[model samples]
Target: MEKGTFQDVNAQVVQRCREGDNRAQYELYKLYSKAMFNVSMRITNDYAESEDVLQEAFISAFKNLHSYKAEASFGSWLKRIVINASVNAVRKRRSELVPLEDRIAGDIPDEEYDDDTEWQVEQVRRAIQRLPDGYRVVLSLYLLEGFDHAEIGEVLGISESTSKSQYSRARKKLLEIMKDTHSMA
Candidate 1:
């Protein structure tokens, strides 16, 4: 993710957006929509909702373009908006947020995770999509989005300990899913 480059490269484009240039808005949207849509999809696990989230995120970004202080890369800034919007969409669809299940069974050795089982991206992606919302979001944020435990905690409104435990469970669940899929295949 050449994210930092966008801060330097997209400066002119962002300025035009701030000044109400429709073409600039379009350009920004064009540049970000696919990646942002993927972010939405990972959270919502529904195509139409991801599309809706992407559109809403772009509109919000354009409307609030002035608030983008250029402290972070434009892509980073936009990604944060997309992530929040996607999470909100998921929350709305589920009547209630499923807080991460905190029960870790004993005797599940940590050494199991260290085994080198090769995994394809698509294989893991399908597995992730099948996870429950709480696990999927935590897993995606920590692994794919490069969010640390503290950042994930902040984003999901949980403590850092909760975030770490949630990620651990999510990783275990993801591996189980992959193994099941492989065995079935």
Candidate 2:
């Protein structure tokens, strides 16, 4: 397929599935299953639970296919479903607590943006994965996913200030991780 063609395929399949076509349902599952699994795994961090989340998310997505207006990309819509499923799985496991600190430390000012872009990308992703859940969620949503504090606050159900604080802490923690690795070398 050509670049960015999957969305077209999904749109067609979704249209068919909306009309109660079973083959379209199977095609949709085949198309999205692996990507959705990764989305669930990223948040849930458990193979079995991620699988369950994927299944549940697919079921939900299929049932709600009518609500998909194709205004947003199909992948984006499917991703939202997968993310919600993963988040629900996490909530089922345990409730997350946001820290009460009202004032977060300042963010690192743009310090001659790192020269080692490749090293930084890999190391930062690893470091982010190592952060506490709250920090990880805020960092992933804000930094990686390009969500503003307000959007993140709505998605994560925390105050915008809390999201900002968590992102600040996540950055600090990532820098610490990078520093430790450099020291080790």
Measured by TM-score, how close is model 2 to the native structure? 0.74
How many clashing residue pairs appear in each of the predictions shown? 0, 0
In order, candidate lDDTs are 0.82, 0.74
Which runs of model 2 end up more than 4 angstroms from their true locations?
1-7, 96-122
Best candidate according to TM-score: 1
Please state every model's RMSD to the true fold in angstroms: 8.1, 8.0
Candidate 2 residues 1-185, lDDT tens each? Answer: 89868777777888999999999999988888998787666566556778999888889988898899899987788888887777776666655343312111232233444568866775565555566666766776676556799987887788999989888988899889778877875
Give the Cα error of residue 15 in candidate 2, in Å: 1.4
C-alpha root-mean-square deviation, candidate 2: 8.0
Q: In model 1, what lDDT does residue 66 have?
A: 84
Query: Tens digit of lDDT per residue, candidate 1, span 110-151?
Result: 232333443365567667877888888988898888999999
* Candidate 1 Cα deviation (angstroms), residue 72: 0.4
